[model samples]
Target: MPPLDSVLAGFADAFTLFNLLFVVAGVAMGQLVGAIPGIGPVMAMAIAIPFTFTLDTLPAVSFLVGIMKGGLFGGAIPAVLINTPGTPDAAATTFDGHPLAAKGKPLKATKMALYSSVTGDAFSDMVLILASAPIAVIALKLGPVEVCALMIFAFAVIAGLVGDSLIKGLIAALLGLLLATVQLDPEQATPRFDFGYFQLYDGVNLVAVAVGMLAVAEIVRRMAEHDGRPQPAAVPQSEEPGARGVSWREYWGCRWTMLRGALIGTGLGALPGLGSTAAAFMSYASAKRGDPGGVPFGEGNLRGIAATESANSAVMGANLIPLLGIGIPGSVSAALLISAFVIHGIQPGPLMFRTQPELVYGIFGAMLMANLCNLIVGQLSLRAWSAAVKAPASFIFPAALIFCIAGVYLSSGGLFGVSIMLIAAAVSLTLTAVGIPVIVLLITFFLGRRFETSLSQALTILDGDPRALTAHPVALILLVGALATGVWMARRR
Candidate 1:
């Protein structure tokens, strides 16, 4: 470990007035973009990158980190309010958050998310500060074979947790895998399902797929149900103390759920390619398995919100571990941070610790400070978002639809993305109408490409030799676990 005095000095650097202001501004801006459909923190950070060129390195880096930490909570706002996930990872949040809102406890649901997000982020940041190097070393041992086996376990868990019928859930997951195959084959670099559309050569845009199925579909369904009628104004939560907010007792009650989520997220985030969306769903599935009789997993359960928010938020801090220790970008956000570091002439890796110890500790301090900022900013913004949900249904649905269209168009795919979104929305509605689990399908689709890439790489490495599996104990264990989980779930159902 670095000398105690150096750590203190680094923290002192982060406490400067300029750094604090940058963090605050970043947190506020992050929440703004995160609450809006399609404009997540990744895009916000990308836009803000050029602006940071004039600033000092610590403040500039802190600002971006603050934005990422804050977005974790902000993404849950719309998921809780209107059944629309502001970010793809927040899709899991919608399973129970929107149900709570419909039950007239929007404030309670949002508060649960806020508390869980901060708690998980703080836990992972502490882990990053103390044990990042060791964790990254362990994470490096997980090769393509291990990753493929892990994805199999994830799919098994999710299929069992999502819907009543195991067969239906598996079918939806298969469809998602099929959708992911539309892109050029990872190994061959040849298109399999593009159907001669040049635009599809790059495959379907994730923003379009996610926003369409989660946001546009819900908007269309609600509009059809109401038939243009104005909804009654939501009653003010202040009128009822018992139902308006989460209590300290309630937060304490979910301590185990949050801890499990944080652990799952940190572990997954340390590995490159596996992302927060998968972590969130995995945590949710675990929580559901532990609680067979409580709150039904998807119907206004506070623990559901806690599970997803904690896991996704934890991912942000844990993603930095590999970047700082091994110079490997664990996720897209970490990849962006790599550019920022390189622009400042700082190379990430073990040598940096000896050369730039103060800067490293300062980054750690900034992460801790960002967590506090997220809490304050998130609490302040809840009222504004709550009021939005209170607007008449006539106004809410129309505005949401407009945002969905605009957001998809502004995404990388442009007009083509918008078209894909419309089609995906229709498909989402059809699947829901037929009693299929849309969340399972969505999760599998999000993970399918990575799973395929890993499987192909694993196969190449093993050269079709069954004996080679013995050398990869981790992969063998994971594959066995996947089979066991599948059988366990099937029997339980």
Candidate 2:
């Protein structure tokens, strides 16, 4: 544990005026963006990264974290009101949320989502704080061989969990690995896939690739599918007295469901690459299984709303566990956060606690603060977000496209960056048009370089001896586990 003074200093750092402003701004933006269909927290974070390049570390990260936290709950607003999930994680919420809205209780459903979201978020944040240090301690003991095995295990797990088709998921992951091999060789300085383009010598710009695939590609897809129609009004019962609020009895009745969902979310999120969408659905399923005949699930059940919202929102904080403890991002949002950390000269891993304890604890403090900010801002901006969701898709996508381009150009510093972004966006769109899972590709791309570096180091330590693996039981076990999981997933398919 960090000393009392260090912890206090960290909280003090996160409590600064600059950090607070960014947090509030980020929450507001997240709520707005998330309330609009076809826009999500990942897209918002990708676009926001460029603007953060000029800010100090704490404020920049606080801003992004605030967005992620707020977006979790914000997504449920559209799900409840219009039956359109603003983010993938909120899809399960639509099951009961829209039904509640149909019954003229949209505000009650929205408030249930809000309260449950904050509860789960706070639960996961506390778990993150309690678990991160111990996990980091164990992670620090891992050798290069063990690290390599762990990476392989993560790859196998992600490939299995991401998509329905195992073959497609594996293909996507392999393609990401191939793309990551571009630029100079890790061992020697010789360039590998530059194609004689001088600009490729430094490899693909992380910001450009990330923004293109996540933000620009989505924008392009939405634009390609655009109809000249405004989205339906979100709040169907905006003026109905019966839909005004949720009572304490209604909220407390689903406490067990909320707690179960939070636990499910936190557990799944700590594993690398199993995302919030999965958590939400899993929690919803569990709730349905446990429900003892009350309003019926999928037919305006408050418990169903509580379950899905809590689980999905809980994932936002829990996903950071792997990132902070083992230096592996569990989702696209965490990957963007890792990029932000790198941009600020901070490296996340076991040593981060020792080398930058203040910064790490400051981030913890900021996360807690962001949850509070998310609740307050989400409540106050409910009407504004409902109004904003009515904006035409034609207007939103074009503006988003412009923002994506500008953000890439500004962050990467020229036409070269813009070109890279455009190329990446094209490729991402092409991949998505097929049966491929672009999310798996993006996650693998983020982790590939680290896997490669660890593999190289492990091989060097082994001195080219194949028998050396027998000396490390942990690595052998992890590799075997990975192989077994892969085979099982293949058979299940």
Candidate 3:
């Protein structure tokens, strides 16, 4: 554990006026973007990275974390009001949220989602605070061989958990690995797949790829789906006589569901690459199964909203566990954070805590502060978001497209980077249309370089002897676990 003084200093750093202002700005921006259908927190973070290049580490990171937390709740706004999920994680929210909205209780549904989101986010933030250091300690003891094995295990788990077809997930992951091979070899200066392009020497730009696939591609997909017809105005309707905010008794009734969802989110978030969308769906399913006789789910049940929102929101915090603990980003959002950390000259993982305890704790404090800000700013801006959602998609998507292009250009600094982004966007759109899971591709891409580096180091240390893996019990165990999981998934399939 960090010493008491270090923790206090971290909090003091995080509470500075500059950091606080960025936090609020980030949350407000996140809320606005998330309420607009087809834009998400990941896209917002990727786009915002260029703007943060000139800022200090604490303010920049706090701003991004604020966006992440605020977007979690903001996604529910459109899900409840327009039957359109602003983010993929909010899809489960639409099941009950839109129904309740149809019943003239949009405010009630939105509030339930907001309260549940804040509760879950706070719970996960506390868990992250208490657990990250201990996990980092364990990680610090692991050798390169163990880390390689751990990456393999993570790959198996991600492939098995993400898509309906394990084969498709593996294919997507392998494609990511292939893309990761485009730059110079780690051990040698020779390029592999640069194809005579000097820009490929650094491999694909992470920010460009992320913005292209996650934001720009989604925009293209939505534009393709859009007809020339205007969208109906999303006017707020009057609530029924009893359809005000959630009653305290009703809130208390679903407490267990929220707890379970938070736990699920935390567990999954700590694991690499199994994202919040899966957690939300799993929590919703579990809630449905556990309370088969309760108020019918998908029929305006508040517990359904509570389960989905809590789990997804909790993931926003808990997804940092692997990133902070082991230097491995567990999701796209965490990957963006890793980029931010790197740009700020702070390496993540166990050594980060030892060398930068104040900064680490400052980030923790910032996360906690963001949660409070999410709750406060979420409420105050509810009416504004509700009104903004009424704007035409045509206006919104064009602006989003311009932002995507400008963000990619600013971050990468050339037409070559913009070209790569456009190509990635096209590929992403194609993959999505073909039913391939783009998330699997993105997560694997994020992890691919780390996996290769660790594996290469492990092999060099072992002198090309495969049996050397047995010398490390942790590595052996993880490989065995990966095998067992593979077998189980195959049988299940």
Candidate 4:
């Protein structure tokens, strides 16, 4: 770990006026996009990434983190107001949130969500601040052999858990791995699959791919799904006395439920590919099971809203654990962040701690600041964001598409990048239509080169001798874990 003084300085660095403005702006923008149907934080972040090219690293990352934290709560706005989830992770919130809205308590329901969201986000960020360095220290001791095995385990677990069909998930992961091999081979000086394009020699632009797959593709999908009719506006909140907000007593009542949900989210978020959607649903289910008599979950229960929002929001911070610790992205959002880190010439891994401890600690500080910004911005703008849920898909999708094109073009520095983005969008759309999870493909593509390089080095060390694996107990254990996960998935299938 860095010296205590260094950590303090890093935290202080995040308090600059420029950084604070970015955090507030990011949080506000995130909530607006998240409240508008079909434009969640992931898409917003992907579209906004290129605009951060000239920003200092700390402010840029802090802005993205702010968006992530704000979006978690903003998603609940539509879930409560319109019976539509703004993001997949907010789907669980609809179970109880909409019911509460129907009862003329839209304000109360949303307030519960915002409070729990901030609490869980702060809890997870604290966990990340405390745990990431130690995990990275331990990870630094592993050799290529162990890293290779660990990657295999990560892939196995990701494939098994991401989508309903394990076979389809595996296929998507393998396809990503193959596509990642398009650049020059690591060992050989020659390009492996450049297809005669010089741009391919340097590999596909990560920003283009991420923006295409997430932002542009989703815009197209939403536009196609629109029925060319104006949707109903959000439910009007109660104007009666004492009905416009959640009281401290009500918020304090669900404290244990929020804590349990936060714990579940943090645990699941640290693992690769499970995603916040799963965490929210799992936490909701657990809350339901544990509280059989209180408000009867799924029927306007404050506890249900607390459970889902807390768990999903907790995921924002906890998902960074693996990325900072071992250089593996735990979710698609984190994969996009990896591109951001790379763009700023900072590689995330154990060495990052040794070489750029200040940056890492600053990121931690920014995360905590984002939580505060999310809460403040969300509270002050609840009614405004709730109203934004009525935004038309036609206008939003086209505008977002423009941003996607512009962002990718600027980041990639050419029309070639735009072409790649269009192609990737087409591919992502097709995959989504077929029920294949695009997230699995994107994350595997992001990590493929590292996995392949580690595997190659491990093999060179072994020299074709299978028995040599015995010398690396960590690798053996990880490989065994991978095999076990595969078998378990097969059985479940």
TM-score each candidate: 0.62, 0.97, 0.94, 0.98
Runs with alpha carbons beyond 4 Å of true place in candidate 2: 234-242
User: What are the runs in model 1 whose C-alpha is more than 4 Å off?
Assistant: 133-238, 385-493
* The candidate that achieves the highest lDDT relative to the unseen native structure: 4
TM-score of 2: 0.97
Q: Which of the two candidates, 2 or 4, achieves a greater lDDT against the reference?
A: 4
lDDT of each: 0.78, 0.88, 0.86, 0.90
In candidate 3, clashing pairs total 0
lDDT of 3: 0.86
How much is the lDDT of residue 350 in candidate 4? 76
Per-candidate count of clashing residue pairs (backbone under 3 Å):
0, 0, 0, 0
Tens-place lDDT per residue, model 3, 1-493, is 7788998999999988888999999999888888887777887887787678788899999999988888888888999988888899999999999998887788888989999999999999999999999999999899889999987887888777777777887888898888888899988979889989988888898778887888889888888887867545663566566575888988998999999999999888888767889999999999999884665899889999999999998887888888888877778898788778866777777788888899999999999888888889977878898776666788888888888788778778877878888999999988877777777787778778888999899989899998887788899999999999878987898
Off by over 4 Å in 3: 235-242, 290-295
| Top-TM-score structure, candidate number | 4
Positional deviation of residue 130's Cα in model 2 after best superposition, in angstroms: 0.6
- Model 1 lDDT tens row, 153-206: 767766775677777878888998889888887778898899887778777766
Per-residue lDDT for 1-493 in model 4, tens only? 8888888888888887889999999899888988887999999999888988999899999898888778888889999988899999999999999998888889999999999999999999999988999999999999999999999999999988988888888999998898899898888869878888989887788899999999989888888889998878667667776567888888988999999999999999999988899999999999998995867888899999999999999887899999999988999889989888878988877777888888889899888888888888888998889778888777889899998988888999989999999999999999988988899999899888888899899999999797999999999999999999989998898
